[model samples]
Structures are given as C-alpha cells and as structure tokens.
Target: MCAYQEAGGTDMKTKNQSPRPALPRTPMTVERGVALIEALVALLIMAFGMVALAGIQSTMRRGSDQALQRGEALRLAQGEMETLRDYSVLSAEAAASGPAGTRAYAGVVSAAASSAGGNTDFSVTRSVADWADPVVGQEQQQAGLREVRVRVQWQDRAGNEQFVMLDSFIARADPALGASLGLPASTSATRRPAERSVSIPVAAKDLGNGTSVFVPSPTATVAWVFNNMTGVITGRCTVAMGTLNSSLTAADVAGCSNNTVGYLLSGVVKFSSAARPDPAQPGGTAWPLDVGIVNSTLNGAISAPVHQCFDDAPTSAANTMAFVSFNCFVEPNNGTPRIWSGRLELSGLNLGGGADAKKVCRYSADYDGNGSVSNSEHPENYNAVSGSLSRQNFLVINATASCPAGAAINPENGVFVNNSTVQQQPR
Candidate 1:
C-alpha cells in the first residue's frame, strides 16, 4: 500500500511538471508577421520625418528667394542714390520744357530707369529755402541743399511689402565758388574780390584753340569793366512765346529766348552781338549753373560750382566747352521724339571733369561749331575736367577777374588744345 501511494504521488508530480509541451512550439509565420508590422511602422515614421524635412526646405527656399529679391531692389535704390550724388545741376534749356515735356536731367534719369527695367521711381523738386528746414534739428540758415530721394519697394513671396529708401543731398551752388545763394556777407568778404568785368573786350581773333575772346587779334589792351550791379539771385523765371515767326537770324534771338537777370555779378562774359551775343546760347547760359532742382524747395536752392552765361552766341567758337550741359529744358523723348512737355527734376551735379568731357565730346560734340550737346554723357567727364585745370578740356572760373590783370584764361598754364574731331551720335 505504502509503495503504491509513493508511485502514484511520483506519477502525479511527473504529469504536472511535463515542461508544458514546449510552449506549443511558437509559429514562425506569426513572428515574421510581427516583424513586418514593426518594420512598416518604422518606415512610416521615417516617411513622416522626410515629408516634414521637405516642407521645411521648401519654406526656407522661398524665404531665401524673397530675401534675395529684396536685396536686389534695395541695391537698385541705393545705387541710384549713389549714382546721382554728383549730378544735381541742369542747364536752362535742359530745365526748359520743349515740345517734349521732359527736362534734360529728367530725361537722363528716365533713360537710366528704362535701361534698368524701370525698377525705381524718380521725381525732382526745387526749393529756394532751407532743405532740412524749419530748424528741425539745427539753426535754419539758407541751407541750400538739393534733396534727392529714391524710394524702392517690392513684394515678398509672402505678399508682404518690402521697401528701401535712399537719400541724396547736393549743393546747388558750391560754397567754394563764393556764389552760394545764402552766403553771409562776412563769408563773401573773406573770398577774393571778383574781377571779371563785362566791359572787357573779347578779341574775336582769339577764337579756337581754347580761347574765349572772339575779337580779332591785336584788339589792343582791351579793358573789361564790371557794371557793379548787384541783384538778388531769384529763382523766379519768366517764360514767354516771344516771336516764334521771327526769322531765325541771330538778331531775333533776344526776343525769342528767355533772359536770366542777376545783378550780384560773380563773373562777366564779354561778347560783341548785343542781340545774339553767343551762338552756343544754352552752353553759355546754362553751363555749370546750379538752378535748384530738388525734392523740396524748402531744402533750398540747388547750387554747385557751375558756369553761367549771359549771352546767346558763344563768345568764341572754342568756348563750346562745358563742364555741364543740358540740351533743352526738354528733348524729344518717350521712346520717340515729339512735342512733349514736362518740368525738370534736378537730381545731381556734374562734378568737375575735363578728361571725361573731352573724351565724350570727341564722340558727341559733333556740332561743336553749330550749337551745344546734352550734358548727360557721364559725370566722370565732369570729374575729368575737375581732375586738373591744365587738361585743356573746359575751364570755368570761380571768381571774377579785372581786365588783363584780373583775367583768367581756360587751359591755363599746362593746358594744351587739340583739333580732334568730336563724336556726338551713338554708333
């Protein structure tokens, strides 16, 4: 009985500890299926990550492109501002409204804008008062600075407005010339007395080869005297249709053209013909003049070291040289030439230049003996003239001179003249 009971107990214990039938032998198929599910989930996660990365890259690219565009536009505006700093003055003819409505200086700016794909907007206004005036920050003096503003704007990819502004200030009359509009009397006293007298006889024989007088040689000890007349340099100019039907003879020129009146004489030019004293009328009257062309008249008169002529005909044929020249108040324009009319927007000045002027005139001054050419060639030409007075291109005196003793001649000293042909038309 005892043995039977022990055997039974042992059999029961063995049956219970049968190793659980090796856990029913796991199915390889199920394991593989599970592995696939895990792999798919991982793949899905990776795909989501890739999609997010692509979106980010696309956004970044668009932003970058917009930024690039803005940068280019800003650069355009800044470049325009920088480019105009040296050319603020315009000739009277260039300042005049021709059959075409554009002024010489404005035409130049427009041409530049067109060539640049019209990426910017330009406008010019003149002022004879304080530019930064009303004494916003400082004392209100004559403050004759021509303010030029170039505003640039564009849309970003996000449809946001982007803009950049460039500002330029130019002096209509350079203080150095002693002809500044609001110059104090004390300052004028410090300057050397002007000696250019209108009575000085200009020898016609002295024409050509860098000479001003047209008087025949040996006009003998000609004496030039100043009228000693002084008048306010008013910006007001009167325009009239004097005698259009009159003959084109030099005699009728006086009645047909606009006259500039100023008594405070900085310099005097002597010419023979009272009716048509100069053939290069604009070249003589408008050369180097800083009649205000600015954004705000309050910014003051546009002044720069410029040449002014009181006559219609050139004193001498050689006097065709101009540091700055504007053909007409307006020229044939808008992709074609017709009687268009518009006001002038003086923006910059033609800094001193003879070398560049000489080079350009060589190509553009074709009608050298006939009349004047536009001063829109290049400011570098002005710089060339300013580089040295001895370059023999064009000479503008800063102060008046007395006859003989006070006389100042262009191409002074080291200047040499050449009989080279001028080029005006484009190739």
Candidate 2:
C-alpha cells in the first residue's frame, strides 16, 4: 500500500484486471514415420521387376542358342548333300570310269557320322530310305533313281534333341555328270521311249517275237543332262498320265531326236522306313530286289544295250523294300510274241548289304530248284553278268491278249513317257 501510494501503480496497471489467463496449451504434434514403409514397398516392387526381367533375359538367351543350333544343323546337312553330289557315282561303270575320287552312289548312304557344329556334336546321315514311305517321296524315286536325304541331329543345352534334313535325288542317268566324269556312253538294252527336247532310250525293238526275241537297240538314247537338284530346289517335268502307248506316245509330247526312249510308270505302294526285312517271310522273299539287272537282250550279246535298273520301294508288310506294281512292254524283235516261258528270278536287300559296303543288298534268288544263288553276281555283276546263271527275276513279258492288225505296237508295242517339267531350276 505504501509503494502504490508512492507511485500510483494501480492506475498504470489498469488492463484486464485479473492476471491474464494463460493461453490454452497446444498439444505436442506427433508423426507416424510412414516414409520407411513406403520405401520398403518400393524396394519390394523393384525386386519383383528385377526377377521378371531376369526371367525374360534367360528366355531370350535360350532362344538365341536354339536358333544358332538350328542354323548350324541345317548348314551341316547342306554341306553333306553337296559332298554326296560331288563324290557319288551312279553305276559300277561310272565308279570305275570316274577320274579318280569317285565313289559308288550306294556309298553315300554308308553310315551315320559324327561332326562338330558350333558347340554341338552333330550326327550326319545320308539315305534313300525315304522310298520305303510310299508317296512320301515318290516324286523323286524311279527305277533308275534314288532319293537321298541328308539329316543332321544334335542335342540342345536344354537336353532336347533337334534335327534338320535336306532331301535330294540321284539318277543313274546324269549325262552331264557322266560326261564330265568321262564315263563311257553305254545304253541299257531294255526298250523304252523318250520324248520332248530331251530323249531317253529303250534297248531294242525285239528282233524277233517270243522265244526267238532278241533285245536292244543302239543310238536310241540322246544325250541329256540331269540337273541333279532336289525337288525343293528344282521341280520335275511331267506329261499328263494316260494309257501307255495307245493314247500317249513319247513322240506325242516328247521324243528322242535319236532313237532314245524313256518310260516312267508309277503307282503307290505302302512301305515303312528303310526298315528290316520280315523274319516271318522266307529269306529274300521279305523284300523286293534292291537293284534289278534286266537284260533286254535275249538273243543278242550282253553288251552296252544292257539295262541296269536300280530301285528301292515301300514294302512295309515285308519289312523291306516296298512292293510296287511293275509292268513294262517288251516283245520279240521279230514281232513274233511270247508266253509264260520267261518267269525270271529276282533278289533281296537286308542284313548283309546294310551295315556297310558289300552289304547294301546282297542278293538271294533260287530259280530252277537251285536252292541258292550263285555268288559270282557280286561286285562284278554291275557292268556285265559276273555269273550268267543266277536265280534272280528277269523280264516278265506282258502277254498278247488281243492283236489289232495295225495297232500302235501293231501286235505288241511298248508303253513310254512323253514329257517332263522341272521346278526351281532351268532345263
């Protein structure tokens, strides 16, 4: 009281009389640290993305490897095909006549071989076994022809097996090759007709008929060059099919400038892989002959006019070369006519001729109750008959059912092909 009286402080403190109430206390702010959780979530998503990317990368790598392997296999197959084309000889004459390095066409299918292709160990194989599958490859097969396939096989890193194949054909008639190889110009005596700008041949018009018939002709086949290309790379020349001689003649659409003739008669026969012969059937009976040697010359000397027909067929039932219906026209050169007196023998292909050379088709024919085939018909048999009297099937003539006086063949005429078309390559 004394101090207030001395300074009159009461007047100076006149504001809100009571001491100013303390402002209400604000509660302390708090935060729930969510950044860490968000960061964790982002990391998890990133991890998943990384895993997916890793999977994609692995898949791409494997695919690349597979592509490379496939290409390599294809290349290997192509190389093998080229090698075969360069080294193979169609006949024994060609083999012997080849300049130096030539080998038999049969040798091309020797065996499967191993080679290195990139990082893979590849197996390479050549075969005409496709003929056993019937029409699967009939376009490239014929009496004087063989279809060769070059296959390459390898294993991938994923433990999967992979393969690629290249298909081609080899014909006994490659004039260009024959000429280049310097092979002799010999013709098979078997009679046939050729046509078009190119002409093939038939041995001889029978000099006589029936038992007195003699085979073969000379200068009938004109020089032709087989392209030696695959059906894939090239196509075949063909004439619309019809009756053998009556309606269709080689000269109708195509004919040899020379006496040349070519006849290709075909029909499908069921077959399997180059399979084994059936044990159920008697030996040699399980399959048809691998190579059939028919001497069109009956009375004439077995010379250049000899017919060398090499073939493979689909004989699934027999588990060997397939049985294809075969019919060709041949008669006495004298125009006489023949009967059943010429039921010839034939041979077989199996165990012996498959594993390697000398085994491709060891034959077995037992005609005349001989019980066995003479052995002299082996290697030496190609050029000429090494053994004259073996039990193999020979010319089975078509009988004289009806005789039109002035028929195309008159009494007995042969059937033949007229034209051929090619694909992928030029004539």
Candidate 3:
C-alpha cells in the first residue's frame, strides 16, 4: 500500500510538471504584443517626421513667394518713380491727365493677398495732392508756383503693401514782365515816386474793327520811366502834337492817298536812366531819351468783332454790358476775358470836320475794344476822327514796354492798366 501511494504521488507530480516546462520556453503572445507596440511606435515617429517635413516645405514655399513678391514690388516702385521723373510740368498737367487704376508692369505679373501667405497680389494706383490756391497766386502772391504731388501705391498677393511719391512745381511761363518794367510785381503794392501815367489817345469811330491804323498823338515824344530800386516802369511826359507835326509835310500824305490822312502811328521811346518827375513842371521826367518807330504787321485783319466787357451795374454786381465791335487779344482766365492794347484811328472823311477840329488823339496801352462803341473808342474825342486817313499808310505802334534788364513788360507786374477805351475824361 505504501509503494502504491508513492507511485500515485509521482504521477501527479509528473502531470503538473509536464506543461510547466513548455510554458517557460517563450512568451509568444507577449512578444507579439511587444512587436505590435514597436511597430506602432515606429509608424508614429515616421508620421511625425513626414508632418514636420511638409510643414518645412510649406514654410519654404511661403518664404520664397514672399521674397518674389517683395522683389516684384520693389521693381514696380522703381518703375513708377522713373515714369514720374519724365514729366517736366507734372502738376499743371495732372488735372488733365492722372493715374487711377491697376496697371500691368513689365508684363507677366500677378498679385493678390489674404490671411494665408501668397493669397493677395500687387497692382498700381495713383492720385494728386495740390499745394496751392490758383486765384491767390494772381491776387496776393503775384507769382505763384503750384505744387502737385503724385503718389503710387501697390499691394502683393501676400497682403503686403508698398508706395512711391513724386512732386512737381508749376507756374506761369509767360507771366507779367511788370517787375522788369518799373511796374509793381503785384496790384497790392505801391507805385514808386518816379512813376507817371501816360495819356494815349485814339479815335474809336473811324477805324473799323479789323483796321490797322496809325494815328499820331499830340505828344510826339514820350519817355518810359523805370525805377531800379522798386522795379517799376511808367510812361513819362509826352511831346505836344504841334511839335510832332513840324517834321512832316502835306506832300507826305499825297503818297498814301488823294485825301492822304494819318491813320495809325506807333513808336518806341527809350530813356538813358529812370528819373523822378520834374517837380517844376508837375509832370514826370526821366534821363536820356531815344525814340524809334516800329513797323509791325498785324497777325489778323482789324475788324469789328464781338467784344464783351463786365462792369459794375446798378445792382452793384459786375455784369456784362453791350457788345462792341473791335480788335482784341483773346486770353482766357478760367473763361473768356477780353483784353486788348492798341490805337483807335479816326478818319476826317468818316467824321465831318473843319479847321481847328483835331481828329487825332493819343492812346495809352490800356485800351479794351469792348462794351459800347464809346467804351472801345477814344473817350476824350468820341466824335472826332484823327483825319481823313488812308488805310494804305498806317504807322506801326511800338506799344510794348521793355524791361530795363531787357525783359518784356505787362500789367501782371502790378501796375493797373487802363485797359479801357476811355481814360480820365471830363465826366
């Protein structure tokens, strides 16, 4: 019985040890699990690396695009700068021509922008900023140079922006040569002591609108007075008509016509120096004098044409009066402002005349052939004709005043020109 028990126990022990031996050899499932875990870890690492690489590529692309856009923008700005530099009078002309919209530059270019890089693009635009008042230039400043600024702005696809700017100075090229002629540079200024008013007479009736006539003045000689200190030039005392007639003979008229008459006359008077008026004579005087006649052909025929003038009416407002027919220089200041300078010669034949009836009258530079016939005619002698004048032999009037420095003279310098057909007449 003892031996049987021992055998049973051994058998039980053997049975228990039989499976234990194989189990310890390898953990197959655990190994598989660990392998799976490693595989998963490697996949995760690879995925992360790929994601990082993609991000780097995206950043690189954005950077490159941005660089390209910036380079293009710089190029565009340079091109625009070059374009603005070519215009000499950019400001004065900008109102007529200006830039407003996107324009292609150097071709093959596109630009845009957005929250994301490289979403927006670049385009060009322009505008002007004025730096001065136009009217004040004439009224107060006398000489006004307007400044115009041009700005160009651009944008890129990456939502980046850039801009360029340019400026120009513009003024009247042929402004009044008054300062050179002893005239004040502007109307607001004072007249110098040496300045004297000249009396230029004319017969408004005899000479038709387009007729170029030479009429002699009572004063044969006159002096152009200039003020070096003040830059003012004025017309001085004129010689009497009786003295002027002493040099000519009736036979001189025969060459022009059967009833030979003086129609127009114009000559220049020069002085050695600008001098003050003769205190004794109560008239203006200047230094050495040089007188010479000028013969100039008219650009257009002198004929009666529509003339318009504005005068203060009963309403106390400036309004246009009756239209007169006369020759005129057309200059538009914003609109039509009819202003002219010349002589009005009358004919003895046009106006019935007798002895002691002087037909000729002198005229100053201030003459506007506008408004009523009287407004454009010589106000002092509205009914008198200078003489029975021959249209063939007209005197060319040297009406222009020269600058002491050899510059041209005009009212723009500050002196008030009569610019009227009439003058200080017996009102």
State the lDDT of candidate 3 residue by residue for 158-239, as single tens digits.
4556554555543433223323556335443122222221111222111222111212333324222222222122112333
Model 2 residue 10 lDDT score: 62
Off by over 4 Å in 2: 2-30, 91-100, 130-142, 175-427
* Shift of residue 38 alpha carbon in model 2, Å: 1.1
Off by over 4 Å in 3: 1-26, 89-121, 132-427
lDDT of 2 by residue, 137-236 (tens): 2332333355788889889988899899888875544333333234344464322333211111122111111101111112112122111111010111
Which ranking of candidates, highest lDDT first? 2, 1, 3
Which 10-residue window in model 1 sums to the lowest lDDT? 383-392
Candidates sorted by TM-score, best first? 2, 1, 3
Model 3: how far residue 63 lies from native, Å? 2.3
TM-score of each: 0.31, 0.39, 0.28
Backbone clash tally (model 2): 52
Give the top-scoring candidate (TM-score): 2
Residue range 1-427, candidate 1, lDDT tens digits: 3534454567654765755555567767765678788899999999999999999999998878766766776767766655544333233364464344333232223222311223323322222223454424432223334456666665566666766666556544321233333334554211323332222222111112221121111211211111222211212122232322121233323232223222111222221212222212213322333222112122332222222222232333455543332211111222211212211222122333543121112212311111333232111122111110111122222112111112111233421222222221111
Per-residue lDDT for 122 in model 2?
90
Question: Candidate 1, overall lDDT?
Answer: 0.31
